[model samples]
Target chain A: MALTRNESAPLFSSDTANTLRLIAYLALAIALMVIDHRNGWLVQVRYFASAAVEPMYRLAALPSRLARSAGDAMSDRARLNTRNAELERELLLAQARLNRLQSVRDQNERLQQLLEAQRSLDLGVQLARIIDVDTDPFRHRVTIDAGARQGVAVGEAVLDAHGVMGQIVEVLPNTSTVMLITDPAHALPVKSERTGLRAIARGNGALDSLELQNVPISADIKPGDMLVTSGLGGHFPAGFPVGTIGSIRNDASGMFAVATVTPSAALDRSGEVLILHNLPDPVGPPAPAPAEGPPAESAPANKAPNP
Target chain B: MNRLRANDWLFWGSIAACYLLQLMPLPQAMLPLKPWWLALVLMYWTLEAPDYVSLGRAFVLGLVGDVFSGDLLGEQALRLCVFCFILLRFRARLRFFPMWQQALAVLALLLNDRIVLLAIRAADGQLVPAASYWLAPFVGMLAWPWVFLLLDDARARLRVRDA
Candidate 1:
């Protein structure tokens, strides 16, 4: 048998053709980027495409999944027993803490009833396991095994056991993409747990740091002050832990203060998360009290109905 | 001819492996250091068997890469297109270079890809990446020789010769 020689031809037939193809492909790519960045026009396209590719992601995740299970199975009995004991003790401690908070919650509810204020609604929460973390260095996103079919909607708040993790940004049929609070584009309205001074916490493209925007230098907030969602935007429920202020300094213009905050959530490591549902719409400025007898000022008297 | 029947299968299989390597979950600290495995593999095929790699293929693969990596839709597509176009232009010289020189050339190519990424990010109004962001190309450069040799061996075994 005659040996066949390897023949590796050039990819393009000619220089002109190469240049033309490159220009065309580049133009298409730029157009896609612009369309994707400008709006949600490509969201459906992405959803369908991701649905088709979901199996590939699962296959890629298989090794890690197997390893995790194998590690779980191979753990020594003594270590498991010790871990069980540790968890039991932690549960007991949490129960004790809950007992104290339970009375305070009851008193607060009673106070609300007496005042005739809108009853605080309890949002539903669902647990989702993080299936994959984005490999792109610039993006801090993860794919959770919950999606539209599971009634996971965009904009739902996600949290780990410790604090707010992020919000759902896109939902495919079987999986959803969650944008971490540490993403550069994300911002959360938060208030100082110590002083109640409201501020916006903006992600600075780092997993460990969030910058509080437009903070006042004279504000009572300081290092170590805990921040919690203010529920002003209605995206996140009120009082969820966000982060702790790390350092504060005046900006370049000295017009406003900037405080760097270390996020409280495990932005890099959480394997499981809780997604909050049934968040109420932004309850626009509270209706003026009827007792004040200012009937003319309360133009929009009808309260927005809660779903 | 009978042996070459599996050529297409092997080619796609290699591409699949590269994608898996790229999408495999990595620790946060190691993410920036993850080399562009798909690029390296594509470069090898383009140099050794350009019949299997083309500009269109590169663009399509990059688009899929973007989806898998969760980047802006066309970001990786553009990056891979530029990468492939450059590789095609210099294939004659690059194919004949000694292993070390070829590795350096690959480094330059990966560095160019990084610059393209930087421009894309800048256009998207993202902040400048950290210094560690530039580290992946060096890692890719170091891995180039081994990748080339490995794929070369695989190609020879698969008998991907001209008809």
Candidate 2:
């Protein structure tokens, strides 16, 4: 079975052509990464790759779907009946509450319209579906099925049923990735609903938890206090629920307090979200137009009286 | 030499098939168990046909893996090159080892590959501790025997058909 070196030489010798092909492949990969990171030249490539891989995901999930259906088919009739009865009871209670909320919402709408006359603000919203969770464990990000095609742009605010989730970071033709509020790199300006003290809320990458930075140890913040988006930054709108204060640990240095807040929105389990597209400017308001004419005769009369 | 040529095609084809399987979306529970099919394939070629595949191919395949997995550039490539170099240096002895010993060796190689990846991530200052991070190589080790047997059987059949 031992073959002479000459006889096996062709099988074992390093082929110059194959080596060149491999070197070419390596060079192409490096070039791709450079272009992708520096200039975003590979966005279309990533999009195409995602589209091509999506069908594979569907195909792989087929067995689980079959198993689930089989399990459902074999479920006991009595268990299904009991589950249905419980759901019906819960539905009735929810409907009763919803009826009361409907009337309250109508009254609020009228009040809001009256306020709008004083300062008109136009806003638009869109809905999107969650597609995938972040592949990197270090980042808290989710990919949504909506993308540039759906008018979802980077920096748009994403909100779930309860409150703000995060902002869109990357947008493709058919999908976009949202960097969730719980991402370690994310920070939002927040105001305590009770004290009106403004502080920055930063994500700790722990699901459902965030920390308020640089709050004075003696400040009037307590457990169970609510935090709302302060609208200091134009990134998010004002008055959206952010989180509730969980625990406060006053440092011996007394310079600051470490407070943990439970995020209002369920970051882990949400299936759908609303992308708020109409975010206002963060800096000073738009400048008013110059006087169109010389001082009017009634200008003095319209001016406020000196105390 | 003819027998070697037959195994080369069989092994390379199996590796391609494995890459396709890696693309298939398994259930969430099974996701962690999805083997490092590319690494297994690279290891096979490194051992069975070192002269043909060599260190450079392992490095290139690793780059392809990085692109497919959406990881940072050169992450998998560096790990695979190191793995292949080690395997290549000992290809002769590795080919003669018992099946169990070979699997153990592969497990060690994969563990080193993971460690190297973690080191790179740590250097970049992004660290997350999770048990699932180590799952891929263990699954790869478990799948090694089956992969080896299946490919070996196919190569034998192909050789007979060719003759």
Candidate 3:
């Protein structure tokens, strides 16, 4: 306000003041960014600021939402009936598949009981619609309509109907930002379904692919091998599909192999996602006895056993 | 005093519109083509009304943008401060330039802003951006002329009504 008051005083002083202010603000910004990136202590500041702008996001999304509803309301009766029939058939098929899964899950529960293993938690999922996409071209993030008010918390894994999408990074009162598995900064622990080979799948900043890090040259990985969450990290539950290995090639170092993974989730297209809650802690305390059994059956009661 | 207040309302209102435009959803294919709407609008005000648009104000506006975008705090602030500083330094000459030349200058400024963004990304250890990453500055450059005329018309109308 003082600066505005003095606007017409003189030009010479203003120019010098401009440069001085630029330097001061630049220093402040750099410090804020360094502190923000390193420790994320500035999240509280962002949390409050984002709350103030929440209505702007809604306003921006208003037109598309209206148009979608209008289009839905205008659909003809015949087309609607066909869509209804198709959805009913799809629901029947899904119910059949769920019945099969129910039996398999029951069997698995029995097996876990026999082995005295902690049963996997029955996680809850809240459905949320994508409200906005990140403006930054490099970062793969999206804002969802559900947030802290809806019991959404930071670090909750998000998934579509098909597979794992990403994890919640920031939770506001009525909105949250989900960092997709394709963000260059994200890394997920995944295992091959066939070989149980564990590797860290790092996002390459591309929506279509992830890269498996530090795989050994002789690792039993092949193209098309399904990758699932290993549950080594307590953030995500086990047996959720992450991606499929696309290609494997030796790294330039020749000692390790790098493989690209095609993410199973429709990262760019999915509008609705389920935010998982109450994830099971699969990585229990270290085992006591060194069992000389096969790795497949060795960690039954200890770390996460195959689903 | 009433006239000044009205002009001030226009100034802040236009800036708010720019923020809305930035936040508006675009198809994934059209995302890289979305020009830097905030920067373009800020450049207009900083040029036409230097008294109202200062470096400190620009920095704060960018901080707001950073918060809204969920980017690293102060990232946009630094970029916008540098942008405002440059525009202020060259404001006199830039004000006299023809429309086409001014658009070219806008292009250069937007490109410089991209470099600032690239430096920040590099410092943050982000992955190298894809080729489409370079397309936004050009889009901003092309959008500059229309944006300038539109805002200039709006300001002229505001001044006429105030008079």
Q: Pick the candidate with the highest TM-score.
A: 1
Clashing pairs in 2: none
Q: What's the true lDDT of residue A142 in model 2?
A: 70
DockQ of 2: 0.21
- Writing each residue's lDDT as its tens digit, candidate 3 over B123-156 gives 9987778888888989998999998999889878
Tens digits of per-residue lDDT, candidate 1, A34-81, equal: 999998577777787876568877887788788878999999999999
- Report the Cα lDDT for residue B143, model 3: 93
State candidate 1's DockQ: 0.52
What is the per-residue lDDT of model 2 for residues A1-307, given as tens digits with 9 covering 90 to 100? 3234324533334342254544565565456555665676555565666665444334433554576679889999999999899978877866665656556556755776776731322344677876543344446777677888888888988877566799988776666778889887799899999989899999886767998877887789999999988766667767778899999996567788988989988787636777877433335664222111111111111111100
Which ranges of candidate 1 are over 4 A from the true structure?
A: A1-17, A71-82, A97-122, A280-307, B160-163
TM-score of 2: 0.70
**Which of 2 and 3 is ahead in TM-score?**
3
- The DockQ values of the predictions, listed in order, are 0.52, 0.21, 0.55
Q: What docking grade does candidate 2 earn? A: incorrect
